[model samples]
Target: MSESKKFSVYLMATLPIVFWGVSFAAAKVALEEADPLLLLFLRFAISLPLLLALAWRGGEAALPTKKQALVLIFMGFMGFYFHLGIQTMAMRTSGSGMANWQMAASPAAAALMSAIFLKERMSRTGLLGALCAFLGVTVVLGLGTKGAKGISIYNFGDFLITVSMLNWAAFMVVTRWLFRDGGYPPLFTIFWEVFFAALMCAPTLALLRVDVGAAARFGAPTWEALLVLGLLCSGLAYAFWYRAAAAIPVPRLMVFQFLQPLVGVVAGYFVIGERFTPWLILGGAMIVSGVYAANSHK
Candidate 1:
């Protein structure tokens, strides 16, 4: 690519990381007034129509084949509902920086899964990078400590977030396989995944019987925040992410995600008054360096 084109792609790719970084903060704020399931349901319900409209305008029609639909459904279950639900729940218990660092495991998980399933090979350097990243995450969260309340003082939130990272990596692997062989449109696939996930979560929301009045009481600021999360972060960001992933190789794109936690952690500290410690800073730097080293080959 030309210098200008490469720069443009970099900007486009970077935008989603920035938006998602801030989304951690917005989600934290939104969660103050909304339950996790309810927030997820609302976010997708509000965003789906717009996404479908875009898909239709782009000439996407009819769902994928039955087999492909099944794959998409599975992906939706794991990626959208399970992955997001867990991550959101983790955020309620952990700081944004910790959550972000936990998610840094995604590339490593993806690489491992690919080696097993796709017969791909991981370089020694990549393995070392992954190990460094893991150690950095451990340092950032101060793993294996005792709490004052006799609660075992473990970073369960960080662990949950890291599990979501594995979930997402699996989702990505399935998506790449489907897209390569199925000839499906990325937008259409994502729309259906989100749509199916919304359907699955509908009953959960009904069970919760979330108070609409409370949701409505946020007035303009709440609505604006929701709009940003739904439209820009969820819809537009996914669009750009898919585009950028298509343009850039997966390993390279994965490196950019390391920036996400830095943004999230700092934003959390400043916006939400979350505590920041030297350990977090040191660990974050290591994680970033590890990710860069892992992806430098591509």
Candidate 2:
């Protein structure tokens, strides 16, 4: 790719990371007033129209084959329905700091899964950069013994987050598989994925007895957070992610995930009075350098 094209690809990839980074803060705000399962349902419900519209506009909105439908449904369930729902619930018990700190492991998990299943390999420099990025995120998040303990019976939420991380890794690999040889455009695939996620979540809402009526009581801030989560994070961000993942190697793209926690910390700083320290500066530099190095050509 030319310099300009590569820059655009990187920029496109960054869009979702930023949306998801701020999403931790948004979910916190919304969860203060809404049930976690309700929040998850609303996220998918609100985003569906937008995704469908986008896919339709792009002229890629054809229905999938039986096999494609199955894969897309699996993607929807694993990626959005299960992963996001579990993560949201986990945050209620464990808190966003713990969640973000644990999420820093996702990129490494993704890279490993890509290597194993997709037969993708990163160069030595890329691996080094990935390690550096991972360390940067650990510093930026200030993960300590409190949250980093290996999962025990008491750490149920932590265990759930670990599951979310692994599920995310598998989701990335499956998405790459769908797109590799020939598949629908990102928006089209994302639309169907989210469609099935929302469809599957509908029954769960009743099984869990989530009060859908609670939405009537949502305040302006709560509604605003929901809209942002739905429209931007779930809707546009997923599309942007799939697009980038389709075009870029999974391992190389996974390196960019290291910035997510840093973004979350910055978002927290502004939204919730989290402090900015010297660690932020040092860690931010390492993360940027690592992403550049990992994505650089041999």
Candidate 3:
């Protein structure tokens, strides 16, 4: 690609990462007033209409075949429903910044899974990078004896976050399998996934007996937070993310993700009064460096 074209691609890819980074702050604000399930319900409920409108405007074709539809639905369940549910739950127990940091594990896990399932191989440098990233995560989480205390066993939020990361990795694998042939537009597939996620989440919302009254009690700031999460983070962010992914090489595009936790950590510190400890910073650096190295090796 030409230099100008490459710069544009980087710019486009940066959008989603920035949006996602800001989302941690927004979600932290939203969760203060809204229940986890309610937060997720509102996010999907608000984004659904906009996503459908975009799909319509794009003149997308009909739904995929029965087999494909089933796969998409499953993908939606794993990626959207399960993933978001776990993440929301995690946020309730763990702070948004920590949750975001933990999520940095996804790309590392994806690389490992790809190697095993897709027969992809990475260079030794890449393996070192992945290791560094893992170490960073450990440090950020405070992995030693003191760190163990930092982990809330009773909270179960951290466990949920770990599960969410695994689910996201699985979703990536499924997405690769379903879209490998490149028959359908990314938006179309994403729409179905969002649709299925919404459908599955509806029952969970009801079961949780989500209180609209609580949502109403939230002030404008909370509402604004939810709006940002729904519109920018979930809806437009995905659109841009897929677009950028298509435009740039996957590894290079993924480097933008390393910025997400950094943004989240800083935002959490300033906005939520979360501490910016040395261990957290050190761990985050390790995780980011490791992941970068691992991807580079590949």
Candidate 4:
């Protein structure tokens, strides 16, 4: 890519990372008043229409084959439904900032999977990076021992955040598989993914698990939070992401993501008063180093 184009790609990728990082705080705010499932529903409800507006423009059918459709549905369930639900519940207790850095294990886990299934070989530096990433996890876990009495290795929310990151890595693997043969536009694929996610989540209201009536009690801040989550975080963020992914080389594109965890820490600090602990700083640095190490082709 040309220098100007690469810069544009970086700018595009940065948009979603910024939105998603701050979104952790938005989600925390929304979760204070709404159930995770309900918050997810409202998020999609706000996000989907806008995505559809953009995704279906110019009269494109952009339909998928039955198999590809199944893949998309499966991706939605794993990526949006189950994983996001876990994240929502976790972020409620974990707070946004620490929850962000807690996800350092994802790229390392992805590297392991690539080695196992794809037969990819990791360099010594890559292996070291993975170890550093998990070492950061240990550091975070050690810090947890200091905070809450009688509980160590962090809270359930932090654990769930780690779980969500693993799910996302699996989601990425499957997405890459679909990309190999799915023959769909990125936005179109995203639309269907969100569609299936919303479809799966629709029953949350009638399931009696959540007080669907609670929506009636939502005040302005809650509404505003969901709107931003759905509109900017979910909608435009994904749009920019797909555009950037298409524009940039995969390796170069991925390197930019290391900034996300760092951004999340800052956003979390200012947005929710979560402090930057020494452990967090050290752990996050290790994780960012690992992400670059793992993603680097050379």
The numbered model that scores best in lDDT is: 2
Q: Model-by-model lDDT, in order?
A: 0.70, 0.84, 0.68, 0.70
Q: Which ten residues in a row have the lowest lDDT in candidate 4?
A: 143-152
What is candidate 4's lDDT per residue for 126-177, written digit by digit as tens? 5665566566555544452223222235788888888888887666555544
lDDT score, candidate 2: 0.84
lDDT per residue (tens digit) for residues 1-298 in model 1? 7777766766777788878888766777778777787778777888788788878887874678898788778878887888878877877876665566656667667766766775555567866776676677566545222221212234877678778887888776666666666466777877888889989888877777866557766656656767877887778777667656555555555556766766666665667566767677787888777765665443
TM-score of each: 0.78, 0.93, 0.78, 0.78
Worst 10 residues of 2 by lDDT: 143-152
Comparing candidate 1 with candidate 2, which one achieves the higher TM-score?
2
For model 3, the stretches where C-alpha displacement exceeds 4 angstroms are 1-5, 56-62, 124-154, 244-255, 273-298
Model 4 TM-score, 2 decimals: 0.78
Ranking of all candidate structures by their lDDT, best first:
2, 1, 4, 3
Model 4 residue 287 distance off true place after TM-score fit, in angstroms? 8.7
- Residue 152 in candidate 2, Cα distance off native in Å: 13
lDDT per residue (tens digit) for residues 1-298 in model 3: 7767766756666677767887866877788888877888788888877777777787763577898788788878888888887787777667664676667767667666766775545667865665666566556545412312353443578788788877776566556545555765667777788888888877876786777578768889889998998888888877666656555433334445665665655555566566666676676677556645654431
Residue 296 in candidate 1, Cα distance off native in Å:
5.5
lDDT of 4: 0.70
Clash pairs for candidate 3:
126-294, 126-297, 129-290, 129-294, 133-287, 133-290, 136-283, 136-287, 140-283
Better model by lDDT: candidate 2 vs candidate 3? 2
